[model samples]
Target: MKSRKFYISVFILFLSVFSVFGQTRKQLEEQRKKLNYEIKQVNSLLFKEKKKVNNALEDLNDLNRKISIRAKLIATINSEARILSKEIRVNETELKELRKKLADLKEDYADMIFKSYKSKSQQSRMMFLLSSQNFHQAYKRLEYMKQYTDFRKKQGEEIVHHSNEVQAVNDSLLVQKALKDKLIVSEKDQKKEIEVDKKHQEKLLATIKKKESSYKRELQSKVKAEKRVTAQIDRKIREEIERANRIAREKLKNAPTKPKSVKKNEFILSPEAKALATKFELNKGKLPWPVSEGIVVRKFGKQPHPSFPGITVNGTGLHIVTKQGQDAQAIFNGSVLNVLVSADGRKNVLIQHGNYISSYNNLEKTYVKKGDTVVTGQKIGQIFTDKVSKKTKLIFVLFKNTTRLNPSSWILRR
Candidate 1:
């Protein structure tokens, strides 16, 4: 019984190990899969315009992201392997203990059986009990015989139980070993991939170094392009504000149930628009991203360049760089305010949510027009992908009436 208790304790301890680390392994596997998919999307961003050099910066960024994810995957694999090894060890030890316990139980049961066989006749046992010195002694003798019979039966049952436990432990050990072997293979594959990626990254770095001046010029042009889109967004937002203000003033001039004063930086809203705006505000930091699959190559607000030194980049929105031909989705239920085109002919869709507005700029084509109501996650437009630079970047901006809001604060963290 003492040995059984010890085995139960060991079994419970091993169970907790699996319960904790098994969940960890599953989560890591999911993360690894998601990162791999994102890397694939990033790779597809490279446009197939023949005779044009790929954007070294964009390629490098993607390679870096891939390398980072692969390294994490390798680490996760090693962690899973370690846990499996520990599990195997624990189960193997338990199997040994169970085998020993089963042997002891079986031996005891066999001894009990032999004694029972030696006392062959029921009449002999009865006569032995009847020859006791007193009534008390006879009763004690009968109790002892009953206890022996029950104990022998229990021993036999224990032997069977321990044998089954041993079999289960053996099976578990095999499974753990197989899992460890698979994880090791996966780790090796991840390492090989990282090595190949690093080599390519080095080659790209060398190429950029040889043409540093030209690359720097290209970087400047890219920065300028981003700034151009940003300026267009701000300008369009101001124009919308003026339009809304004009409508509000006309309403105030004609309506008898007018408010005393118009609130600053807030558009005049109908009751439905006010409710939608409240809902949008309530969903702050939880809004869906404009694109389904992309990376935030440039973040909202002022920040330093990823590769360029001493260069400051500023934007009011999150810049998601995605693959070619990706459609922009509306983040919330709202009416299309306007579909404006930039100087370079890239279109942008502005959707108004009560006092708030969201702008998806740098679209190749618009799918909705002004005054058209759209639902959340509805397709609004296709994003513009630059043919010359092989760049497909989206500028996503948010606004509270005329005030610019950082889009990073609103979009979901993918």
Candidate 2:
């Protein structure tokens, strides 16, 4: 009975350990998978064309940050796997101990029952009772017999309980062993991921080495492309703003009642337009990207050169890099104010959202024409990829009454 109790305690301890270890292993596996996916994305981006010299330093910095995070995650998972392995080993040893205890309990119980049966005889028991010195003694003997029977019953129950405990401990031990096997596999995978991450770091370092020569050529090309697109869009916007202003003036003059007041750029701010701008502002951090799935490879505003000193580039809006053949959509409901081709020959589509204007440049083709109304998320055109770089970048710009604003501040950040 004492041995049975001890086995039960050991079984409980093993179960507790198994549960804790299993949960830890699961968490480690999840982290390992996430790290692996991130590493793959970094590798894909790294191997794609040569790095952009202007953004190379910044990109390299970002990649290094990701690599650091991956390394830490791998280390954490490895530690967890090690802990699980130790726990599994301890569980196995405890299971073995429990089985031995159960076997000994069964043998002892069997011996006791066999001895009791052998010593029991109906005639002998009755005679022994009568042989007592007095009636009180006989009564006492009867009570002792009852006590002995109960003790035997209790012993039998204890044996069964210990047997059950032994089985439970064995089941837990099997479960722990399986979990340990999974952890081993996860550990190996983490090591492979770390190796791949190191390769990516090496590739980034190599790319950064040739930064000077490449920066000049890439910057010139980017500036030329940006200037062409910007000029084309600006020209179209000027025409539309003038035309809209003229129409509004004519409408006011033709009205039966005299105008209350007329301010330059004032008529452009219609109540509807102001409301839309307010809504767009309200969604400052929540606006969706013009393209569905991509990262903002380039941001809005002035940025330093990746390789040269005293060199900087100004971005009127944002440049998003997406997969080839991706579509550029309208960010909000607006009218297609203009559809023109930039000097670079890429199609540009402009939409007027109330007083604000949104532009989608570097399109291969335009789907909407001037004066057409477009709903939010409406597909306007497909983005064009640079053949030399093989980069599919879309130039997105936002304007209010001809004043340019950074598109990054308005759209959701990736």
Question: Highest lDDT, which number?
Answer: 1
- Candidate 1 Cα deviation (angstroms), residue 280: 1.8
- Cα lDDT tens digits, model 2, 1-414, are 122332353345434434333446567667666666655555454345664433554555455545454555546565576776777688778778878887887788789888777767535678879889999999999999899889889878887887888788778767767876776776677568656655665565566565656756776787787676677667767777878878866776766765555444433555676787788677776767899866555577888543344567777888777777889999988788888875657888888877778889889988899999998888999999766556777889888768898887888754
After TM-score superposition, what is the CA distance of residue 331 in candidate 2 from its true location, in Å?
1.8
lDDT of 1 by residue, 1-414 (tens): 122332353345434434334456567567657756765665565323342556776676666656665655565566667767777888888888888888888887888788788785545778889889999999999999899779877887888888888888898888778878888887788788878987887777677677777877887887798777667677777777778878877877877787555565567776677899899999999999888887876677787654555667787687788777889999999999899887778898999999898988889998899999999999999998777676778888888887888887887877
Give each model's whole-structure lDDT. Answer: 0.76, 0.71
TM-score result, candidate 1: 0.79
Top-TM-score candidate index? 1
